[model samples]
Target: MKESVNSYVFHHCVTIPTIRKGGPRNNTKTYSTVDDAENHLSPQHFCLPHTLFNRSFLVAVILLELGFGSIPMATSLDTSSTYSGILSSSSPCFVRPSGSGTVYYYQAIQVTVFAWGMHTFSSSSLMDTFSCLYNETFFPDRSSQNLIESDDDSNGAHQFRIRLNLQPGRAYILVVTTFSEIVTGSFQITATGPMQPVLSSAQPITTTASYVLSSSSPEFARPYAYDYNNVPYQAILVTVSMTGMYTFKSSSSIDTSGYLYNEPFNSSDSYRNLIISDDDSGGNLQFQINASLQSSHSYVLVVTPYRKAVTGRFLIEAAGPERLELTTYRHSAGPYSCGNKLTCKAGGLLKIIKSMVISVGCVGLLIGVFCCRPCTNKRKRTLRQQLSLLRQNPISQANSIPLRNVSINTGRTNEIDRPYTISISTVAATYAEQPPPTYEAAVLSSQR
Candidate 1:
């Protein structure tokens, strides 16, 4: 009987049974233990012993499988680390840096674990063999705690959740290990919040002008103008005031020979040339005159020891309005005399009158040249020829005339016999002249 029990345990413990056909039976029966069949198999052999032994073997195998094949239970514990893990053993774990800053705050932390084990007894008996353990450690304090609990319930698994109220700018560590069997697991934790930064202030400087000139020896000192406040200044509103001496000369030919000498001057040569420099501060901004000038002969010397800003367009309000007005200044040199110095005063007067007539005739000629209509084919042909000549030699024929003052004959006829002295003065004139009212006005006036 002992041999039979040992045989049954060994066969069922390692291998499952395979069905086979029965062939022979023993007529004689023997009893070795009390747990054997009651009949002792005296009359015939009984199969009850084989059936009872198989049933007991199956129950033991089932119990052993249940205990060994199941996973262990686990629980979470609180810690300062941003992350956590669970396993069969406990050891120090490191948390990665969360943000870029001197200080860091922890919002919350979490952990999880999984465990497994095995047994050699019945299901209920195997439950008593397995267990769960949770270990936690706090930083700075170094204080630690452990919890042990049975994990023998259904499926053999357990889970625990931990919440952490951690201090900022600190670190902590955690370790976990198993007690009875080879069960294992891991845990995780997280942290979150905001960070701060540093900054600095702005500085200021004075503005000055930078100049560029078209000519190598520019006549005037380039003026520097600017506004301070740092706010943008409007280029159009700003104006520059300049003061300097200007010299003018008229065309000698017109003074000595034109018929319109006494007539009111209507030509561009009547005015003085005023050139203004256009240079702003270092920003290189340029100012340009929006209007054109017609006068060139007359000159003015303005001395603006004082200046003022005015609101009107093109009108500069002077600090001393009266002093701002220009006065005539005479040069040491006398009126220019060209060609023969006549001995007869009558001849001088006649020459003056002839110059006046010639001036008028020139003006009339210009009007006729521009206004005459081509009434006939011959006139048109003549006009075309004149236009061609004018185009071919415009500067030589017209633009070369210089500016000069008109001279009136004031001496007596016999006075020309002696040395005649004439004085000349420079005067200021309008910067521009308006054109004749119409082409007809310009042409008809020529008849006189």
Candidate 2:
């Protein structure tokens, strides 16, 4: 029995039937051992032996599979001395000081120079007091730009490294020697700037929305083919939603340009797959790209500066329709489709115009009926008065009619001429009855 228990643990085998608390029970379905333990454990209850194990054993195994004992590292970056050659210095070059200062040599290429890593250097043990001097003047004289020194290369080992950006064809001298005396000895120094960092080394971006990029961040993409402001650039992956036009733009304080690539940039050679590159043509020095994109395609966007070394905060924007539209597409019956936006507004406007015209016509009709009713009553009253006057003095009523204004140009006979009266406006007559307020009004009235 003990041997069977040991075999069961080693082979991960289990025997069912005849397992009892005090001893073996013979009445149950008898089996010497079970072929599959999982089959016996979950669906059907097994009379497991308490002598060999407890109830928590299966759960404990599950916990171990869940990595209970395995823990992830708490931190990623390593600041220990073990990172010796990881961000290593350039190859140490031998230099000797003959005359003024110890001179080391280096050259820069292209229109701009991007310092890669921190400049680094080391001095010989023979010199107790020494400093590293760097300047652009080829041969130093009184007028040559006074030396910039790096006597301690951040590690404080009496080593030296001073970073300098030298233009093409401009000669620079990096001298390593004592303050006053010209020392003649070999010194190991890295005659180069820092090594350029890369895309993977940049901050990882995973979001789909707009984000801000600063020169202060650990990101910038500069293809080797680019001679201008490799400035700083950040990598972003965007998913194209539809097969249509999409715009990527930047609104930045500094002049900026945006470059789109079909793939993540690894080498300068990847620029051959560039979709489009826009400079100030977008807005300011900012970039804008409008491209016909395929649905479900992923694009890599690189945001950079236009002028070399100029970097600031910039905003990225994407525009144009990528979703389904009802009005634009004939098949779409969506509530607010392209057709709905315009047609809905137009229908509302038509309804409003129609209602306004009907309301105005109805009001004018009502007003006309109301005004005509009073005029009709007055006409009947006048007719009744005329009839009564006809019964009394019809001749006097006809003679009582008011006369109209007669033009002075009428050719009437002077012999039978009656008293002619011409009525003027009450305002003008009021003014004529009085005196004019001023000389202008008096003149206008008198001329009239």
Candidate 3:
């Protein structure tokens, strides 16, 4: 048996019409096989749409296939395996016998160029520059029969579209290339979902006051304090309304109530009408007196509360009385005094004089009784007589010698005598006679 060596040939050609500014345009068609051209062409050079041209190209391919008789080729192709270039390359082509009963298989190669034009073009015209070559193979192989595609331009993007009749259950590699250096980029596609809503609750509010006034224009000096919870608070807008004998007064003077008149009291002012607002937390508000007020001037100051979305409560309390205006008097040294003067006038001086006089009179009376009573006493006569004698003869000469001698003797005699010697027996006169007492008694007895 003689062994036959199989030879293969394949051809690929592409022609691009040069675009001119103003040129005659012609419609042209291309075919790959003689049979394809003959069956499809209309005597003109044009072939059927998408049909291959050039009969010689098909003949050369067949002759090469016959040269390699009895050789087997890959039935499937992988384009990436054969494609290679700095910027461009070709892809591997796979062949099996045409849908006929023949078992012969063929292999081919295809060249592709990716070019980017600054201007946009139709997709059909963009893929026309590609070419392919087919050859017969003699051996069965398991390696890939695929190729990578390439482009010729490097300055900008070059895009092309390709058509393939891919097998449903088989995997294949597709290749793209460029003439210029590959400028890599990325692309992505995505999708999204739906949206939603939110709901919330608001805060409860409260308020209180420090002072409330009683004048129609009474100063509602105390501020209102407000509180809130759960919701955000913004500002407190205060409005003061009055009932009874009062009205809201907005003035800058003493006669009227300057309630929320010139807004925004500053730090330097001594008083203010303020409505303070804070966040969900609580804060203090202040109002202050502008002028004094009188009693019985009844008034009511109302406080209102507000916030961003939250509300607040308010209360009113009265500031105390105005200062007392008292009249002063200068005291005179007289009766009808009220203070220290009255105390001095009442009984202080009289009590002092009466006490002095009583003390002096009592002392004088005591002295008079001591002197006169002694003189009046008969038993004290001797002492009075002696005192009188001494007073009469306070100084005496030789004539006084007698008095001195007398006094000396008297003093000596009085001293020498015993107290019992001066008896009543000598001092009393003779008793009445009881002469016959004894005799009478005797006679009576004899008679009896």
Candidate 4:
């Protein structure tokens, strides 16, 4: 009996017919097109677009079969795999040999394997010289810790190969670049391991969804680095179906910042549950957070502003293994408001009632005391008219006879200072020896 071996070939060959020119001192010959490069270096089978499209179409079909909304692990593995890609001027580049050095163009491909073991990566390029780096990060020159292993075609064979121990489900970056600066061309990578690897471009499939922050949204004391006090923001519950590195970015006119909190986000203690946060890293005063998230766990995405009380519409793009499950997250505890049932404690309620009573009582007393001048003046006018009528009666005024008492002063400061209740006869007798008292003088004497 013969054993059947699984083989999968993934290609990323895009042919740009634009002719490239090399520097004056450069000895490397430049190819005008992808076909010319393939004809010169690689086998005919390696550059076939039909095979590449067919594999992509197969993956798409598999995705649709699984609802096309989730990220699924590769079902099949190959003992050997082949991948092809091109490096143009538009490809991502970094300065070789660190600061103030020559710039080189490179392409980074993420390779993931289901079965862990030793994997070998070898590359063939149409250009005469190229190098490879098995790195943890994209720009290996930036940090030595990121560069796991590196190799160049020291044999002058126009090829490079590297061998490294890989863990299952961990994504390793295979960086391919030229030995010289500013060199661009097409290349192919063939990987062999315990299982056929899933070769995906370093870029993930990102899905952008629109959300909003407005007056009605819940608020929180954003992390101190962002703002001091509470700010209007929207919280999204992020749940991933697969575990992988994910990036969350915010785009809006409101200089936005983002905070990612682990399960059970406690707004009261934001820093404790916080997994990561960012501000203006996405450019244009937006936030970008890249984190490794676990499956079936809860994560809270907080969209706030760089300053307090900022509210507007914003778009959130989540890029990872799969489209994340995002929904508006209103904390089970809700917001802190005196009106909320959970937030209104007994002491708070008492304080609220006390405040209301004090405010209402003071306002009512002020209105009653200072707002009735016209009514008081009308009463005084009636009293004056009564006095004038008494003065008009000559016989009654001359007799100085006792009559019903007349109240004068209306204040209640003291018993004697209150409205006077003296008889008209007494008033006439008291003022008889002096000039007839004016009404104003009589009223002033009553007040005294």
Candidate 5:
């Protein structure tokens, strides 16, 4: 009976009775104890164990199987450590310095317990999606050789596993981020190695990104130091995922200045939205600004020269607790304007010229309609009246003066008293507004 109890506890084998054709019979049947022990122990078995000793042994086995001393089953050493955390909007984000890709929550896991062996890093998502990245350097954008390995998913599961040989007593950064942007949830990470590896929560890494300011960039007025002049500037639209203080510094051969605006940057009204400005604080005529920023909020960072009309190429370095999404921002063009300062000013001059031309044309049109057009009409009417008068009475040029026939004496007078006579027709010319002369009058005038 004691042997039977031991078999059930250790080997999980149970004894059962069987029915035969002859009569009431007892044939021991073995059952696996891996399953529920209560299911295998039937009420009929109580009757089979007729003695009190076997009943006590059976009770002891049942108690052990029911989880009273289950830890005695050869439990191996726990050579792994687990950490749990949640990724939310409050978590620091990881962003690409190139400003392209999904933003990830910069979750860092610092190896606490030091071990001298190859470490296997694995992570599993509890609620939402996540991934794993192993790196030696705290900040990846500064050093490219820090990335040891990365894994998105393992065998189509929301878990990642990476095997890397890590140095003992040295800090190893494990970045647990999500697969998509703004995806937040809970996760679990386990680090297993030859020795126990303890993982603890660590602070977010400092994110640094570089950009340039050139001639073709935007321009704004320096609102600081009572100076309001247009200076060429580069506007960077910064979107931070974590709330903390950020530093911006400029590096260039020319004198550079920095300005931070809380909301949208307006060139015309830059002073109204100014949050902070720095000039020559970074040393060597460069600008350095340190301001507190918030998450889910946007800001404009303007890098310009300290003086007006100064333009050149310059580099901007932004450092923050979490990664910043930096994009080159250009102001939208107006209806009759362009983006660049030169083109926009040219457009304004063109608009002024256009307005002046329109005004001159309107004045000339008024003069022609009211003054010059009436004078032209009066002169045309006078010329028409004179033409009608000429058409009414025609002037006869041949009968302007009266003439009559006459006889003249010549050397041919000795020819039987014959004389040469000349004759002319009688006609009279008339003027406008005067009657024609009678034929008798015309004949009398000619004779006289």
Candidate 6:
């Protein structure tokens, strides 16, 4: 019997011009024109016409006007694993190197890299002191710029820990050695992203998901003299199902910086293309990232010590449906703030508003027509009276008069919009000094 190796990776291969002895695979038809291919009938042909986005926008607007609509966002942690390695350092210094190893993972995300002396029966494990190094260099050497962060204990203990915003499909090296002189020992290394709570509920049986992070929870160590991996912090992830606003905050004692990512932290690209990053909304030293998120996508949220220094365990929260708080902070000062996005709390309002729109909209429209009909008729009558008055005035009735229509904007709420067509002859007759009147009027008056 042959045994299969579980450690080997499997790959897929595609052969070009893949023609079979029979017809094309799956009896697929070939098209000479691009139009034919575009119109090809398939399961994807009868899709929903890509119209949901427009409808969703309209629905969102209506929901807002009705004062109701909120979206849901799901927060979860990345899955992680641990690995083992050995380190030996002789005459260890910043100059002469000792031992280094790398860890690789898929799907870049903000990661918490933990490296400390693993407990073993050997006494060397007790005396073993190690410093962790991290960076993005394909082959990380001590002198490369890829080495952004390194950590050593302040009190000179044999343990080291650091957290970094790491990228996916990238490599990071963790180096361990004695602080100054010769030392060697076995060590354990583990990298973990924030994890989802175990007792998760579809409805979330509790108000929120709770977590406790501290130096003991996952040892975060700062390396000596920034040779590699610099920023050490754990990142939590939250997936949003709808495009809406969300708020993330942490209460840690360390001055904290919170970062929001459209994609999980995998490379330098994650930092450059940030969804939102906030160091401190106020001078309170708390981190907060507030932004609107799109649906059907995962967002990574990282809450870390402000500067990769000593930090105390603190609770953090990611919450939504900020309608109340949102209204309060409409034009507040720089210190106070509400989320800067929309939410799903209005879904209930959407339903009620839709119902009201159906019933009330029809009623209001009918009332508008009924009330406006009389006003319209009254306006026509008023216009006729005004024209009659113009005719009664002798100057307006005169022949050979240059009649000019004039527009007069009325101040009355019920005034008609039709322009008041006052003749130029009327104005001239009213103001000009009559030269004993026009010839015909003069003759008629003399005869009378």
Candidates in order have lDDT scores of: 0.26, 0.44, 0.28, 0.66, 0.62, 0.43
**Per-residue error (Å), model 2, residue 234:** 1.3
TM-score of 5: 0.36
The C-alpha RMSD in Å for every predicted model, in order, reads 38.6, 28.0, 43.4, 25.7, 21.6, 34.3
Residue-by-residue lDDT tens digits, candidate 2, 188-290: 4333333321111111111124445565743334554255423556656666555644556677787777777664343234454578787765646566665
Top candidate (lDDT): 4
Listed in order, each prediction's TM-score against the native is: 0.13, 0.24, 0.13, 0.38, 0.36, 0.23
Q: Which 10 residues in a row give candidate 6 its minimum summed lDDT?
A: 197-206
Candidate 6 versus truth, CA RMSD in Å, comes to: 34.3
**Pairs that clash in candidate 5:** 12-33
Put down candidate 4 lDDT per residue, 112-217, tens digits, no spaces.
8778788888887777445455545553335234667767764348677787788885657777777777677898888888888777677555778789877887
Best by TM-score: 4
Better of 4 and 6 by lDDT: 4
lDDT tens string, model 5, 1-448? 2134443443223442232224322433343552444466442232232233343455554554343442222224538888898886545565522224534555777775465667777777754344444455555333224656666666247677787777686667677776666677888888888778878777644444556555666655567643556576777888889776566777789888788986566777767457988888677898777666787878888877777666677777676668788887655654122333554466579899999999999999998789966875676567557545544544632533322333333333443322333343323222325779999999999999
Rank order (by lDDT, best first) = 4, 5, 2, 6, 3, 1
lDDT of 1 by residue, 214-332 (tens): 22211211123222112111111111122211111111111010011111111222221233322211111212111111122222221110012211111121111012222222222
For each of the candidates, give the backbone clash count. 39, 11, 40, 2, 1, 29
Task: Let me know the TM-score candidate 3 reaches against the reference structure.
Answer: 0.13
